[model samples]
Every structure is written in structure tokens, then in C-alpha cells.
Target: MTRGNQREKAREKNLKKQQQNKKGNKNDGLSNLQRKEKDAEIMRQKQAAAAAKKK
Candidate 1:
């Protein structure tokens, strides 16, 4: 029983480590160009909405 508990704990620890590694590479999920294009598109939409509201 104790050995089973230890294995479970180790598995949980390994899962947590993997999740942390994935979290740390958040920026790598998008290419630089893609990220910039996404940001620009978001900004463009926001500005257009604001302009429409002003009119």
C-alpha cells in the first residue's frame, strides 16, 4: 500500500513538472509573425468599433 502511494505521488509530481514546462513555453505556441498579426487585427477591430461608436 505504501509503495502504491509512493508511485502515485511520483506520477503526480511528474505530471506537475510537465505542466509547468508547458506553461513556461506559452509564448512559443505562436510564431512571432503570427502573434504580431493577431495583435494588429485585435487592435484594428477595437479601433473600428470605437470609431463607429463615436459617429
Candidate 2:
């Protein structure tokens, strides 16, 4: 009886974690393409700064 209770608790916890992960991913402000574009812009700025320093 105790073992069954533990298994039920574990199953509920696992379900909660899965739901949280699904909601967390959806809350991200940027879509995949926007994220990639922002990253590329940041990289370009860093490269420009390095080039300026070298000159």
C-alpha cells in the first residue's frame, strides 16, 4: 500500500514538471528566427569592436 502511494506521488510530480517545461518554453519573448537574428547582430557588434581595436 505504501509503495503504491509513492508511485502515485512520483507520477504527479513528473506531470507537473512536464507542464512547467511546456509553459516555460512558450513564454520566451522571441521566436527562433528572432533569436537567431539578435544573436547575429550581437556577434557583428563584437567583431566591429575588435576591428576598431586592432586599427
Candidate 3:
């Protein structure tokens, strides 16, 4: 009886962890795209500043 209880507790913990990991993976994928866009924006700003200095 105690063994069965332990197994049930372990299973519940693992299931919750799996759910959190899935959500984290989805969020990570979105953050990556945002990071790329931010980098590109920064590069464009630098180029604009350089061009203004040249003018």
C-alpha cells in the first residue's frame, strides 16, 4: 500500500514537470524569434548612426 502511494506521488510530480517543460519550450521558441528581431533592429540603428555621421 505504501509502495502504491509512492508510485502515485512520483507519477504526479513527473507529470507536472513535463507540463512545465512543455510550456517552457514553447516560450523559449518565441523568445528566440524576439531576440533575432531585437538584434536586427540594433544593427539597423547602428548603420543609421554611421550613415548620419558620414553625411
Candidate 4:
């Protein structure tokens, strides 16, 4: 029906938007392992800062 067509169009629009947003991401080209390593390094730096503050 007409309602079903509208729902399908909306779903397609949302998928396109999501794909566009993904293209704009900062880690667009990085591999999963590299991302994890970068995140872990950031966490370590934050932990060291917190420890220094507590001392």
C-alpha cells in the first residue's frame, strides 16, 4: 500500500544517511587492530594522568 512504500523510502533514506556519516568518520581507513591499539594508548595516558593527580 501507500504506507508501505513510505516506510521503504524512509528506510532507504536512513541507510544512505548512515553510509554518508560513516564516510566522515575519523577512523575511516584504520584497521580494527590499529583502532584498538590507539584507544588503548589513550586510556593508558589518561590513567597515568589520574594517578599523577592522586599523588
The best candidate by lDDT is 4
What stretches of model 1 exceed 4 Å from their correct place?
Answer: 1-28
Lowest summed-lDDT stretch of 10 residues in model 2?
Answer: 22-31
Writing each residue's lDDT as its tens digit, candidate 4 over 1-55 gives 9999999999999999999998889786899999999999999999999999999
lDDT of each: 0.92, 0.91, 0.88, 0.95
Cα lDDT tens digits for candidate 1, 1-55:
8999999999999999999998887456799999899889999999999999999
Q: Candidates ranked by lDDT, best first?
A: 4, 1, 2, 3
Q: Pick by TM-score: which candidate is best?
A: 4
Task: For residues 6-43, write the lDDT of model 3, one tens digit per residue.
Answer: 99999999999999988875345557779788878999
Off by over 4 Å in 2: 26-31, 42-55
Model 4 residue runs over 4 Å out of place are 1-20
Q: Which 10-residue window in model 1 sums to the lowest lDDT?
A: 21-30
Give the alpha carbon lDDT tens digit for every residue of 1-55 in model 2. Answer: 9999999999999999999988877426998899888889999999999999999
Model 2 global lDDT (CA atoms, 0 to 1): 0.91
Model 2 compared with the native: what TM-score? 0.55
Per-model TM-score on C-alpha atoms: 0.51, 0.55, 0.48, 0.58
Clashes of each: 0, 0, 0, 0
lDDT of 1 at 51: 100
